[model samples]
Target: MFSELQTEIEARYDIHFDDLSLLEEALTQANYINEHPNYHGRDYQRLEFLGDAIMQQSSAVYLFKRYPDWDEGRLTELRILMVQTRSFAALSRELHLDHYVQLGHGEEISGARNRDSLLEDLWEAFIGALYLDQGQDAVMNLLEQVFFSKIDTGFYDRFVDYKSKLQELLQKNGTVDINYQKISEEQIENNEQIFTVAVQLNGKQLAVGEGKSTKDAEKVAARRAYKDLTMDK
Candidate 1:
């Protein structure tokens, strides 16, 4: 039934599915199921949940090993950015996966197929299908093409949270309690509040950063500290 999509997907990813139903479920949206009523076709929500976890694990392991110097917080943030709804949607669009989504009449009228949330779910569900039909390695193969390859080529480097990067650097050998203390918050000429925060390592102030909020300030401080550490290395 999904022969055309299967052929296209196989040609694109260089892998054939043992069970075409996996691909079918991945493409079938909930609305489509509602429209079918008595039809036994499964929706993608359950698959999406599973896919979410799989992607998280794959990216976590990849980031952990690839960026040996990055800290937990930084890795968390980077993974967040990578797995964000829009990110998944963009990846789906790039694969032309959106074209294969099975939507209900109302959904097609409402244009749900092109939406970020729906596309994101479809993408995750597709990953879930790949994992179920093959295994983690198969899903990882797809990730390498979309996610890891982008990282290697410096596509996502700009989004790195430097503060987390610094924290990760400090804890490379063992546990380290890092502190970000708020120094001051004052109104500037435009009446906008600005904050200064100091990042301390082992009771010693390593660097300070200024921003519009404590979180931003801490991130700035961490970026500075990371810069210093890398320069010294």
Candidate 2:
């Protein structure tokens, strides 16, 4: 029944699921099951939960083994960069896993497939399903091939902690109030909203930026604020 999907997955990731239903479960959103009353399969939520823990464990192990010279604080930050929403979403996009996600008609029409949060969840769910169908070694091998390989090639450089950098810079000259304010939100196609956020220092706006979510917009604003403040010095 899932011959095509199985073929594509194996071709892309060099891995295969003995039980294709597990793959379907990973791709199935809650709304999809809600819309299909006769559907006996489960949604991705539980798998996502399990996958999240697996991802964290894999990241911690990788960091510990690879960066033996680094301390706990530095390793923790690097692991955060590895498993964050944006990173997972980006990885899902790179693998074209978003294309396989099964959504309800409403969610499909609403552009949930393109949402970063959904993509992140889908990635985790897929990982969870894979672990169940395969094993821990298979999960580790897949991550090494698809995810950690990218890290080795500097994929993580894009996830710089601009927010923390900006805060540290602003606090260098004694403590000052730092805030991120939403200036506006505009609805785009498919009901997706774009948020505009401004980074403020001492109640004064430093820079303004925009993104698909508030957190992303704040990151952009912080990056801009950091750059602007540093460029003057």
Candidate 3:
């Protein structure tokens, strides 16, 4: 029944399912189940739940190992940015997985297949199915090929602003005095000026960084402090 999808999967990721029924279950939706009363197979909800957990573990481990310098907070934020619903939905569309979802007649007409929420669920369900059928290595291989590769400096810049992130983390408990101060400026090679900035908490310097501009230096300092504080925690 999923021969076409199987072929596509094999061609795209070199993965072949041991049991195609798992794939079918992953693609199936509750609406389809409701429409077909005789259908005894499961829908994607349970698989979605399981897939979410698998994604968390897989992504967390990947981030933890790949970025040994990253503090827990940064790793957590990056993991969330990578596995969040919007990201999963975007990935599903990128892989053309949305086209294979088995929606009911009404859902098909209503465009549920295009909905981000549905696509998110479908992606998780598919991951769940793939893990169950082919084991963790297979799923990890798929993720390493398609998912983790998508995370780059561009992705980090788009989702993470270090100054803002640091401020949010520090202020999580209560009001905190956080400030950035430019300590020194010097003209370097090519007549470019370098600025040194320090981030302070509670009237004490936490970390310092240098950049081309005061703002940039402050951002760097904030990032350093954030990483240091999060690591301490």
Per-prediction backbone clash count: 1, 0, 0
Can you give the lDDT of residue 113 in candidate 1? 77
Tell me, by TM-score, which candidate is best: 2
Order of models, best lDDT first: 2, 3, 1
Candidate 2: residue 152 lDDT (0-100): 68
Candidate 3 clashes: the total is: 0
Candidate 1 local lDDT, residue 205: 94
At residue 225, candidate 1 shows an lDDT of 88
Top candidate by lDDT: 2
Residue-level lDDT tens digits of model 2 in 122-190: 899889999999999989988988888887665775688899999999899899999999999999999
lDDT of all predictions, in order shown?
0.85, 0.88, 0.87
TM-score of each: 0.67, 0.71, 0.68
* True-structure RMSD, every candidate: 8.2, 7.7, 7.5
Write out the backbone clash pairs for model 2: none
| Span of 10 residues, lowest total lDDT, candidate 1 | 151-160
